[model samples]
Target: DQQVKQNSPSLSVQEGRISILNCDYTNSMFDYFLWYKKYPAEGPTFLISISSIKDKNEDGRFTVFLNKSAKHLSLHIVPSQPGDSAVYFCAASEGRGSNYKLTFGKGTLLTVNP
Candidate 1:
């Protein structure tokens, strides 16, 4: 059973628009949620993260929202630029020190039309 799931396979948006990516999890043990962006051939690079204790976290143009009660989370990119077009994977893991492994979604391919 996949713990983390991204229902949408892809998303398209204008270069200056907002991109919203959704993610869901079935495991309640997950205490941390993260979003990673991957290029065509490059490794996934971490974008934003939120702890179970908080409902939201923001970094510059990226914002991550977590709804622990529903086991749901979302990543929002405002004014998405052309370079922001990439595959985004939502990952989850337990708290630090438990040596937990991350569970990742299939990924959503984001296309920012120039």
Candidate 2:
């Protein structure tokens, strides 16, 4: 079973528009949620994160909202730029510990049209 799922494999948007990416998880034990952005061959870079204790977390142009009750989460980018075009991976982990193993979604590729 896929504990995490990104229903949309790709999204296209005009530059300076809002980009929204959605993710869902079935595991109730996942406590830490994170969004990572990846470009072509480079490794993923952490964009933002939210603890299960909190419902939302934001950093500059990036915002992540988590609905613990619904087992869902979403990432929003305001005024999305061409530079923001990349593959976004939603991941979950138990917590910060030895047993922490990140479970990643298939990924959502965002294309910002210039």
**Largest lDDT belongs to which candidate?**
2
The CA lDDT at 38 in model 1 is 99
Clashing pairs in model 1, backbone N/Cα/C closer than 3 A: none
Q: TM-score for all predictions?
A: 0.97, 0.97
TM-score of 2: 0.97
Record all residue pairs in model 2 with backbone atoms less than 3 Å apart, i.e. clashing.
Answer: none
Worst 10 residues of 2 by lDDT: 92-101
For residues 1-114, what per-residue lDDT tens digits would candidate 1 score against the true structure? Answer: 989999999999999999999999999999999999999989999999999999999999999999988899999999899999999999999767768789899999999999
Runs in model 2 lying further than 4 Å from the true structure = none
Q: What are the per-residue Cα lDDT tens digits for candidate 2 across 1-114?
A: 899999999999999999999999999989999999999989999899999999999999999999999999999999899999999999999778887799999999999999
Roughly what TM-score does model 1 have, to 2 decimal places?
Answer: 0.97
